[model samples]
Target chain A: MATNQQRDTNLSPDEARALRFDVEEFNTEYARILDAQDIDAWPDFFTTDGFYRITGRENYDAGLTIGLVWCDGRPMMQDRAAAVKTTMVHAPRYLRHYNSNVRVTGVDGDGTIHSESNYLVVETLMEEETRIFQAGLYIDQFVREDGGMLLKSRDCIYDSLLIPNDMVYPV
Target chain B: MPDTPFIDDGSNLPLSELRWPDDDLTRIPDWIYTSDEVFQRERERIFFGESWCFVALEAEIPDPGSFKRSYVGDVPVIVSRDQDGEVHVFENRCAHRGVEFCRDLRGKAENFTCPYHQWMYDLSGKLMAVPFRRGDRGEGGMPKDFKLEDHNPKKLNVTIRHGVVFASFSETVESLEDYLGPDNLEQFDVVFKGRKLKILGFYKNRLQGNWKLYHENLKDPYHATLLHVYLATFRLMVAGQKSAMICDESGRHSTMASAKDDDIEITEETASQMKSAFREGMELSDPEFLNYVQEFDSPWTVTMQIIWPNLIVQRELNTLGIRHIVPRGPNALDMYWTMFGYDDDTPEMDKHRLKQANLMGPSGYLGVDDNEAIKFLQDGFKHSQDGEGIVKLEPEKEGSTQTLISEASVRALYRHYREVMDI
Candidate 1:
């Protein structure tokens, strides 16, 4: 469902047409990699100085600089991936993320594209009913790297105020 | 399921029927956890009983008209600062028909008008006016003998210590100082200590377990080193560190503190003894978070003070926070975590606090396990009915512990609980 599609927020006709295809491919691949549980490769899709965070909309909307996971660079993200993949002990589960309403919101003076998409993640734990795990806006800042788009920053701003239990997997 | 009309309903039997296994406060019956009756009793005997419950920080409502919604026990209440700079806390329910007046979480407002019938109230919870109180052209309205004074919302006794605010439902609940006892009050003053509080942020979560389990989780001190390997891996709070679990005289309040031991020399024997805690391969690529600046007067790196039923004052190094436990029902409890820092925190000190946040919250290395472990305990009781738990750590049976590895505080919590609930 998240294939190559042209989506624009506030951009010229030519700029929107240029970004829609490559940016869509980058985001689709990003989601596919995480959904496929190849989580170790997550840090590779970002620049060496990339930033990523998972936070509730309450803190984000209020301009509070706090997050459930705040990693300033790729090395930190790699360490997080390592921990979640190996060391953490949590309930057995499966997760599927549905990302829609993708759009390029703005372009910075430095040619970095500010993009956003609505996401819904459904988690199915062992022998339990599948439920909507998290719903949020993935605010992304994309930069071109070696002929392909790489994320400079990604903020998962969830609307759900209260976390149900342990968020075992990174959203 | 249909046959049971009131399943899990805590039947209010005689107080004698709910007897403890013994008088030593060592064993905790499982029924107290799953009992609806015990929960209801707590709401009345403790929440509405003589206990000071932490409501909000005075800094949250710095302005005269600022107000924030909070929970006192299970009842909804509004904490607002009036025009005279006096803090006021009252039940959010309208005296008329019991409809909730304020729905907003926090806002600046001089008046709270119930949307149900358009009844208005001032910041002091005094009924200011009513829509069409007299009449519409003298036809359909209130009777001539209506008294507005009789309809005022229930006002609570508000206490402000340092920057923290507390409210008590009972008009005669002992002074906040006496209620906390001298030792606990001194520890309470340690974090609060008259320094202006700067609001940082908030993180809230709901666990599907009884509320006391969370209290016990904080009090256990035993779970810290064993369950959360991150504390051990980073050498933040190992069991080998100098720690103390101090309980008040009545065991109603307690403070569990752990110091960073700089003197411990690591030998081969010590390393092997600590092998289970420290994983060899796990390393934080960015370990700048481990850097600690001595902020407090005390040498302890981590201190968690349980203010009886509702409040948890926590200081994990420089990252300070308060946890407000709101028991939703017999089976579910919600935790409102307000993360804050002192007003005069240096820029580097602030960043240090934010980075060290990795140790707590939904995704925190140590905190992630504690939240889920509470669920695991609640799940344990599902298999058997009328079963109980044993908390006999520290064979001396003292309520306080000299080491981190003891259930002394857990027993102390129930000891006070039994006295309060009179079970």
Candidate 2:
């Protein structure tokens, strides 16, 4: 027996409109935190067991298990934030994320929502020109928590073959 | 009696503007890492000469039409399995105008047509047809007797061993076995194991340094003990362990292997007291990543093998991978890492590999540091009037040695590099 996920189509126009507004607000906050390099507060954006990964679309479509940064749970992400900040010393840079073309693709019977949006991150070092750091799609799964949208999973599927110098920040 | 077998004696100098530092393999002239003259010569002699460059794995293209984009030096090539289940690798250039025909990194394609002139070629790179061959009005096409058989993209001699693919530009290049030698072959086959491979993912990045620096890094196990803290922080590798740094007769290919001591238990107290890269009170929240499931019978839990100029086969406690190096210029090079696991891996085993993958890649605890060290070397020598690097650790011994605290393998790399480069 097939689940009704494919053919539900039961989202009313008004409900879909409201969900889109909430998703837009959620993404705005997401970009603000990342661009500000508020890495310490990253955990608050996700659930206790959220999954975050940054990989190439090639690997994502092939269902490969590896990523540039593969965080299976909240602890892994927390560890990364802690280690890179305290232990690792690398050239500092600034990043700004521009997310657009957002689309809320689906909503489960539960409060879970599926979404995708086009994203391009610009990276600027001390003296270098602001270059296109990474361009990709954000494949996301979100749910309501404390009356605000919280990410359950965020798969950053980048398009380029080569990552410049260092992907220091979470793109 | 002179203690050092080779030394910078500073005598009888026939310095024709580009001589290396004395006769010692340890003292490398800064010029080799900085000269445009040397970089140009290397492209032809080292890359196109009698060297078997790692192109792709047999498992990368699993189906008849499957393909992967790869590099042989700076030249782009398409590694595709043809309809009859035979693997063929050909230059991505179109014979018509020398333009790159295969644009996408990879995909299934029956035939490719040049976008410039629409000259069609089959999967085997044979020229099949040209659009408007006789012209729309039978007036402006090729000559009446033009032969379509004359044109094809350059094809290379490909050798597939244990699911690893090596290609050579020279048709007369020795067999893969002859090139790798018995010692290197045994080490190379240890990881390949004739088991089916499943490509897990890739991590691609560039280093702001010479491409050969990447090769030397793998050959020099001296740095692994000093540079990477995560190795010892997790008790994966500790100095003075049972290890071997083995090289082939040519000294171009080498393997640095270190066996794990399963009996040792790592704690904050034991770590801080040790003089190694171990840190006190620095333990992983998820220690499961450090577990080395003895999937192989080799004494070593970690083995980093360098197959001459292009490839690195790594088995760091069951997290297997092959990193391909593409030289962009004298100052920069791109690295493409293909991480994999056995096709028959259990879910538990797969997670183990993925968790440990944090040990490598761009943000990898150990991997990024390797990139930084090489970049520092390149920058450190950019404007130096006279500078040379000392690889004289465990001096006088240039071939395979048992000690982990040795730069003997770095000497091995330069020995073969000089012979091929005739510098």
True contacts kept of 1: 0.51
* Clash statistics: count for each candidate: 1, 0
DockQ of each: 0.51, 0.33
Can you write out model 2's per-residue Cα lDDT over B1-423, one digit (the tens) per residue? 111222232211232457876777879887787676677778889888899999998888888888888999989998988899888888999988899988877788888888999999888878999888787776798888988888889988899898888888899899999999998899888888767998888888888788989888887777776666666655566666688998998889998899888556665554564554666467555556678898885888889998888999988887899999999867788998999999999998888888888777887767777877887777776656667889988886887999877898888788888887887
- Can you write out model 1's per-residue Cα lDDT over B290-405, one digit (the tens) per residue? 66677677867888899878999988877788989899876678888888887888887666777766667778766778887887787665444556789888867667777877
Query: lDDT of model 1 at residue B201?
Result: 74
* Candidate 1: tens digits of C-alpha lDDT, residues A43-105: 998899999888888777668777788777898788778767755656777888788777777
Candidate 1 Cα misplacement greater than 4 A, ranges: A1-10, B1-16, B262-276
Cα RMSDs, all models:
3.5, 6.1
How many steric overlaps does candidate 1 have? 1
What are the TM-scores, per candidate, against the unseen true structure?
0.93, 0.89
